[model samples]
Target: MHLERLVFILEVVGQKGRATVADICAQSDLPKPTAYRLVQDLVSSGLLESPARGSFAIGKRLRRITLSDYSDPALLEVIAPVLANAASAYGAAFFLSRLRGHWVEILHVATPETGVSYLHPGIGKRPLHACSCAKAIAAVSPELLSRDELKGQLRQYTEHTITNREDLAAELEAIRAKGYAECVEELERGISSVATTLTKTGAGSTVSIGATASVRVFTPATRNKIGKALSEMSQELSCALGWNDADAERICA
Candidate 1:
């Protein structure tokens, strides 16, 4: 009843990017007046915000709660230093990505001192097929990319981007076999990334640890080194997150 309506309203606002009371009512069977009242209540409670005069969006409080539940601060403390060390060592940018609802987004970043012309992609939803971070998780958790919304609809950011569904399917399979994913100028020209999925826990949050650099810098050996590093860090973090080897095999394998 009320609970369902609130969840539905949140979903509508989330999916629409910004949803108005009228927009929400139109999507659900709730009456216009009831929707308006509920929307106001949500805004008052800090779960939603009126970004525009009439449109509503996710609020600061909700985002905070989501982040806390999905990414523990203690774990992130360990992750941050790992990214900094990796970035410094490789002379590249190291990033941590996490699931936001159903979307995997860049959560944090550490960049090397010398790079101004590299690591252009910023914090936002990552392409499931083209991004090594997203692919790493999607390889283990296939349900995330198998949704109807993404089937055969992967956007091509560069010539190397895999747009074909069949090709992308094979790519995911390879990622599983390798235990890491590498993007060779797929998301952008000259920029490439290598990522591996974090070990899973019962909390249901999916994350990836990755490193990005200029194509010229990653060369063959450097790429392998970063890939190995990401894999090992991902494993350590996975253990700290509390799932055991048997559980990982059951859930991932």
Candidate 2:
């Protein structure tokens, strides 16, 4: 198919970082003339750049589009496989969420069909004080709460919700020190979760990944295990996003 060939050419160029007509043809198994034409078209359209007479690399337009997607927090291409693995390995409902203003929006969720209860956090605005995903974001950037004046405005969803600013600040400090957040019956009764911040931004807003389960099912051992898993996965995701361990520590600190 034409679309398939176009995608193939792009993939080859992307993987190689820079490719020539010969390289593109070899990688895509296309005729030299066809590869040349496609590469020329891409270069003309600003999706690929010709640095020299024959070599091509990703263009400014493509990088700009990728940056736009990252800013929009719709980078599911990178997040999906990690979430799937976490859900399968942990036997819990894993979710990816982004912070927008004062709310943490559930962008994606992955859970097993038969083994786990449907732990969809539902796609919408969520509070920052009571859930692990939001808490993870808060732990990384406490200034969001301060800037939005949400510290004193937190609502008590359940008896365990952190209602006061002082207590919530202490909780965030603990989460920052531990590199993750855990919630037990805070947002809803009998539900518990552990979460870690996945992506750090200069804007002081963070994205997080987390897993949720019933309190009855999450023992201390399970909680510790899931917490470790989330933290490790978060570090991996952060690295993929170009944040090294030192960058992550400084940003989170």
Candidate 3:
């Protein structure tokens, strides 16, 4: 029964590309307790990973076994040099993020070998309304925000965080026009970050990359500089992943 349940759950995830425990329970007619326990065990064993609450994506073990085309595993490794270079050049920290199914989350971070650092946006989910990485990706792909409760329920991480849905929409429009997003004391009082979404989309997900540093160091002039740099990096990273400007343009169009 355990093996059968495991295989059935894997099949459901494979078919949906990603699936929630509820999805499994509904499809397989499995009891809630049975489905939840199996999914939890799979996630713990690296056979699955929960990218969002109640959402499961293939884990590293499965990716390796299937040689999946998704770049989640290799993304950070392939771009390590890029992130390190940018971080070193700016004397700050950099990170990568992704939106799969319906949510966006930080995947990795790169920091300068030695620098006068002020704050670091630790890896994992940050408030969507206050995170540059999440906003950059969500601006281009609004559907990614579907899994998040936005409507009038934006979380205010700091006083500077935008709590109004309309204001968030306006901010996203600006990000779309500027080709990047910035956070100034929004997520944290003295931490700032700049990010841009990869114009290219793949494997049913959108990718974003960004850098973070102290608010004092990321001043107006430095903010613009870092924002532009991240935009260019987004393009380069997208192109490297077998996607070109034309591909993204067609999708956006």
Candidate 4:
């Protein structure tokens, strides 16, 4: 039964957009009778959806699996204004992201007011080892750096990107102690960014806020100021999410 269920799931997702039961059966190398039965079961269980007469696709339940916690209205409301304020204050782009699986997915972004530079909309996937926001979260969430998962071969996004695992480990430790991370044209040639992670209640998923500027405008002093602001905002959000005083102090200090 488990094998049949797994085959059904694989067939459905492998279809990418949609597929008919017959298509799934053909892909799974399963008998038509068994495929029909499993497909019916999956559809009834909300694991698959039929948008058209015969076409089946991933269901709302499967979609919700990727965005489970982001549905929190309280978390959204609290973080949105903070990102917006940072974008306005610094005249730079701001992003709110959360570690999702092996990647950091940007959930929100605020564009600069002056509209001088093109805005890189922050809604997408970023590599955990390379992005400022992802690195900030990974610094505190050891689960992200589990030796069993991504043991070696960190990819370099740019010339300044950290590719050595030991060096990256040390850098992440420093970020944990300082409560923030910075990238100076590391991910992209001309972009500079700073980020801070917020993990409340010790068990919930970690979130991060990132602000980006053109390298020309991101001097050391400005990066320091932005890092300070991001650290404070991260602490405030962490407090809202019920982090203890010690955790808050460690993050803010």
Task: Please list the C-alpha lDDT of all candidates, in the order they appear.
Answer: 0.76, 0.75, 0.75, 0.71
lDDT of 2 at 57: 79
What are the RMSDs of all candidates, in order? 6.7, 13.0, 7.5, 7.3
Q: lDDT tens string, model 2, 34-153?
A: 888888888888988988888887788988886633533335677778888777776778988776545676778888655755465566556788888898898878887786457456
Highest TM-score scorer:
3
Ranking by TM-score: 3, 1, 4, 2
Which model, 1 or 3, shows the larger TM-score? 3
| Model 2 segments more than 4 A misplaced | 1-68, 71-74, 113-118, 199-205, 245-253
lDDT of 4 by residue, 171-231 (tens): 9988877778888877789888888876533523367888888778878888889889987
TM-scores across all candidates? 0.68, 0.67, 0.70, 0.68
Clashing pairs for predicted structure model 2, backbone only: none
Comparison by lDDT, 2 against 4, better one: 2
lDDT of 1 by residue, 1-253 (tens): 7997898788667645677888787666789999999999999999999888998988899988875323235456767887887777767788988654445778688887765545645777787888899888888787766677675558899999999878888998998887789999898888888998776434323678898888888887888888888877776666655544654555443
lDDT of 2 at 201: 49
TM-score for candidate 4:
0.68
- What lDDT does model 1 reach? 0.76
Answer with 1 or 2, whichever has the higher TM-score: 1
